[model samples]
Target: MTTTSEHTQSVATATPSRMLRYLPASALLIDAALMTLVGLVAIVGRRELDVFASSAQVEDQLVLAGPLMIVGWIATVALLGGYRRDVFGVGTDEYRRVLNASLLAAGVTGVVCYLARFDLSRGFFLLAYGLGVPSLILGRMALRRALHSARRRGLLRHRVLIAGSRAHIDEIARVLGREPWLGYEVIGALTPEYDLSEETATGVPVVGNADEATSLAKAYNADSIFFAGGAVGSSSQFRRAIWELEHESIQVVIAPSVTDISNERINIRPVGGLPLMHIEPPTWSDASRWGKRLFDLAGSLFLVLVFSPLFAFAALSVKLHDRGPVLFRQERIGKDGGRFACLKFRTMVVDAEARLNSLHEASGHSEGLFKMKDDPRITVPGRWLRRFSIDELPQLFNVVRGDMSLVGPRPPLLREVESYDVDTTRRLHVRPGMTGLWQVSGRSDLTWDEAIRLDLYYVDNWSMLQDISILTKTLGAVVSSRGAY
Candidate 1:
């Protein structure tokens, strides 16, 4: 019988990596095409000439410019990682790369013009750079939408196999479930510890053991196999599996055991015989505290100025719907065990807090946490306000008053603060937020454990960049209304 190692070796070598096959080539071609069209327009527009101009001299100049533009496009894209598989059709990373590539191209053209003693019109380069960056970004945006739509219809997807302990494999499944646009359809998982029966784990079926992992992956025609943590017994086993998979044309992804390692801080060095991953723990200092405070102050001030009209509108809406108070100010825990009144629009009735005790037994949310999804106290206008998160607009005042921030952990109610275990209190290490990791992540859908973990992650990794990213995502999440109640 053919050994599992032999079977896998056949697959990996035989199947070319999809990175080279799909996204890169397509991206390069689209970019080159875009550059070519832009170059033609720039040449004609700068010369103040028309297509098929009566003058042969204009046509000759255009012809010469075309090849130079093509060369510049190729050189720029290569230098800027425009064809990297990892960046294709996802996130702002792709657009950022495109902009970097265009800028690099301009630099190359600038240097070449100086060296060659050609009096190239500066207007041509300026026009191309100005138009090309936005054009390329727009093109990628359109293509990304098309690709995402295709993924939803079940096309352009990869079949993947995961190898790990049951828990880690399940974690991978949950992650993949959230990113349908990534186009990973997990085929199954392989575990050495248990038979992991044929039944599906997290919607992915368990295929077989480690010894038979390669064969099973091939049998399913898997495009990629992920070796999750705690699955492979030894380095030899991993090497043997990689060698075997080489013949079967399957790619491999080794999941690291480390958690809480940000992409910014993790570096990999292939030493002697091992790929050693070097992770530097986040360095925190007093400077970070002052910087964060400054950011919070400036951001809060800007938001207050921009949203002043919205605040007036919200106050008017609340007053017209229910002749109750416009603002709801409740005492909540803040940084260093401080007390502050968190502000929000009065979405519930004036007597909502008084009625809470009577309806305690029927409360649909966490008992220690105060959440009432379908509370009878909510007015008709409150539902619309809550759905779009307009009700939380008053928290800008809290931010202005130094009681809250644009991004941070949520401030628990006085009763909820009292219910906290020692570990849960870590959330209070920073000032509370108008919208937090919990709010943008899953809000009411998050379990208490998940909520705490995310909060801690934010505290440990707090940076102005992270805060801005979270705040931007918060706007999108609020608009999409995912997991919002």
Candidate 2:
């Protein structure tokens, strides 16, 4: 087996390219340019072709306000941590920051104009605010997609060295490895002396013990050092390790023991100069819950209207192909273990369930789940419908009926729910979804454990932004049909 040093050297040779290093700066510059362009356009549009003929005082005010607005917007984003490296390619935090910064910039500009008695055109101000914020958000999204593409190809990622007990390091490595878009490439691990092997359970090489973590991290040229739960024996020791790494300009991250918690629910308080992390209980606030319900109702209604033609086509095709029912409705476990009939376009032969046992040996799915790459029970039209996820279109009605949401954990069949362990049953905490994180991530191809993990993560971290992101990706996943049966 290769020694830990050799493994570290091999990984260090694969460091991300110089172009990757400048991504944040490039994004910042592009945002600045976009803001300036939007501001100039707003000014010119408001003044029309007579911009130059405007009073000298007005022109001077416009010039001064334009630069100040641009500078202030950029500064606000910076202060809000929009340009942080960790926020570059994953989640909605970056977009939220950009929005916050834009609003702050607009509010400050309005206050300044009021104090100075400069009559800034309301039309111009509104136009600039409206256009610039969306443009900046879109630009960031575009950059994030580019970065994700690079990460998938192993081109842009931080070389991460994990420090912790064997079990924690293994868990961390497994989770990080599954999310390439998060852009952490684990180079190796540092564990306590009890571990003999030079490799983690997940096969991330063990480079050193915690005592030698700083040196090993440097040797590996790691971009970040992640301390898994109980990596050091004490908080003071962990602080010392962080201090040592900071002197070397290395980034340090500590993974809390908790899983599936959203950052929005976490607060850090400093007491007696010691930082304490407090986790707020998950919000089941009526307003938030009802807000989601309202969104689901509206979205489902809109989709049902828009896809009425496709739904008719599917129904006609299913009926003509096999003279079977046009829709498939099966009892599924919903929120709080309530039984509801989940709807789908019929995508199987009339006796699909009766034939299920016969095909079990060839199905290749684990217990409590059923999937087959080329299930013979699927009719020709049904296969086509499944490939494009058209069969799921009828779930919109379920959404409208309040039995499901546009996004949430997958609705589990009654049998599947019966087999769910205590931990897995947490999936029933929220209404099932028409499409969700699992649908976008891998759909039918994911292993039971992987699917359950994703479902639990979604359950704990549900947000409007996350739901939108999943829905947007679901279209791509359907088109690709990589994991569809």
lDDT of each: 0.74, 0.84
Pairs in clash, predicted candidate 2: none
Error of 1 at 43 (Å): 4.6
- Ten-residue region with minimum lDDT total, candidate 1: 49-58
lDDT of 1: 0.74
Number of the top candidate by TM-score?
A: 2
Give residue 179's error in model 2 in angstroms.
Answer: 0.8
- Residue lDDT tens for model 2, 92-181: 889999999889989999998899888777767887898999999999988988988988888878888888888898888877888888
Q: Number of the top candidate by lDDT? A: 2
